[model samples]
Target: MQFANQTGGNDFTLQGLLNSADTSVPLFFAFLCIFLVTISGNVIILTVVTMDRSLQTPMYFFLSNLSFLEIWYTMTIVPKLLANLIIKSNNISFSGCMAQLFFFVTFGATECYLLLVMAYDRYLAICKPLYYSSLMDTSTCLQLVAGSWVTGVLTGLIPVLFISHLNFCASRHVNHFYCDIPPLLELSCSNIYLTEISIFILSLVVLFSCLLLTLVSYVFIVNSILQIKSNSSRNRTFSTCGAHLTVVLIYYGTMIFMYVRPHSSYSSDLKKFISVFYTVVTPGLNPIIYSLRNKEVKMSVKKIAHRVLPSGFKKTQKNVKSIF
Candidate 1:
């Protein structure tokens, strides 16, 4: 396969979701809608958490950070994806591809750490209720959030540095929507044994380590909940974790399937679908999941809605005055 412009240039042509022009318009609109929803949902979550004093707790603080990460994560890939759907030539500059790979990995890994942190926060809240407040104070929460970002950036940087030195000889078509490590590695002309091993090891260290911590935290959380005498009390405590658990299941489920396995086993089409689901779909669904399931978030949304809608607030006030 004669790679396009392989003489001296490093430009890559992305073989996006569907190569046919007939499907482009529909796919473009579909992804456009997904992008808008992803942006709007995460933005609202971030806005509501920032504006509402009621949501000024450790849980929501972590949530806001997650929202912030999701927004950037979606932006890193989806816009380019949408463009690829519409445009025939999905040529991305070498530097642009590297930048995309960097941010995509950064946000993706950051989310892993953030989710783990959120799990630990939930564990502390449920298992150690008496000390939850003192232990997860504002400073501590900030530190955790900061640590996740730092860790993600560092972890993501390692792979990018290794991949940068790789030589791509002929085939420049990346068989995915984004610059994922596996596909990028597949395109390398250099002997990728060390690179593949390094990526696998790094992925295991980052993804599985976080997964283990999250599981351990939840195990203790479940144990503590089981000891509760009142069913209502146990249910209420469990409800607080319901949203995070749902997100973790979706996020980790797609991620582990994509990254945890050997690159040789990855079917290009299947990996593309999975990537879209996690990168595009999950971020959009996260705010919806939290808002629908978490009563606290729902209540906060209503409170903000009331504050925003004058007519509704007036009617509510009139009802209250009549009752008085």
Candidate 2:
């Protein structure tokens, strides 16, 4: 009956909170606070982007999609993580594991590609300012953004299929918190030759392709920055990308820490820590990133806040309807 101990069978055990260090009430509270912040922050971003007409450009359009993706991304992992932190013994059903794996892979891959797309947008804006609008038209933008989502989702399904095909004979105790590829692959009882190769190829595709794209965009952006005639012009251009660059540093730095390297060097705790940055912190920070440097987002947020502020603040509907 015990799957963790079963030999060449599908019996697998998920890891528990206590299995990791510092499984306590305070840790649970910390995670809970993070979840609340992530949800609220991303929602605010979506609202601000949706409400603002000035922000209706291809860049903000992609950002809104990203914000939506972030909300779902957090939803996929955080609730279960919160539950696991509170539950004495954390266990997930086979189907639950598969579902978690599916969304996690999909969203993680989507975020990576989305970031790359944003980089490319910045590159165009900087390297070819005159043609930026023409090149990054609405339909083209939609194609890139929508393509990233569908591609990530479809590729994500392949891994889940392989995971389902695996005959799990050995210990099913996933060392990491969530349903991750490496830990799941480690538990497979069947000879995973095809799965292994498929994952390797796909990982290389997702990891290297996006990373190279981002890097190339930055290379061109830097070249563009240097060629600007005036200091103020350069500063203005750099400022536009500053927040996004900060985010890219944090997101890609952490991602490359695990994904860009050989898998054998991986540490579970290290992986968990870095994954938390992209999966948990990135959502909360994204709203902050897009809103902080952006005047349109700020003005829109102020208007939205004015509209939504609790009953005591406003007289009401007569004059304000026109401004919105």
Q: What is the C-alpha RMSD of each candidate to the true structure, in Å?
A: 4.3, 4.7
After superposition, which runs of candidate 2 have C-alpha atoms over 4 Å from their true positions? 1-12, 17-23, 229-233, 260-265, 308-324
Cα deviation of 228, candidate 2, in Å: 3.6
Name the best candidate (by TM-score).
1
lDDT of 2 at 213: 84
Mind sharing the TM-score for model 1? 0.89
lDDT of 2 by residue, 30-104 (tens): 878878877776776777778778788888888888888888999998887777777754667677788898999
**167 Cα displacement, candidate 2 (Å):** 0.6
TM-score against native, each model: 0.89, 0.85
Task: Give the alpha-carbon lDDT of every model.
Answer: 0.82, 0.76
Candidate 1 per-residue C-alpha lDDT over 205-248 given as tens digits, one digit per residue, 9 for 90 to 100: 88889988998998899899889999998888777666667778
Off by over 4 Å in 1: 1-9, 236-243, 311-324
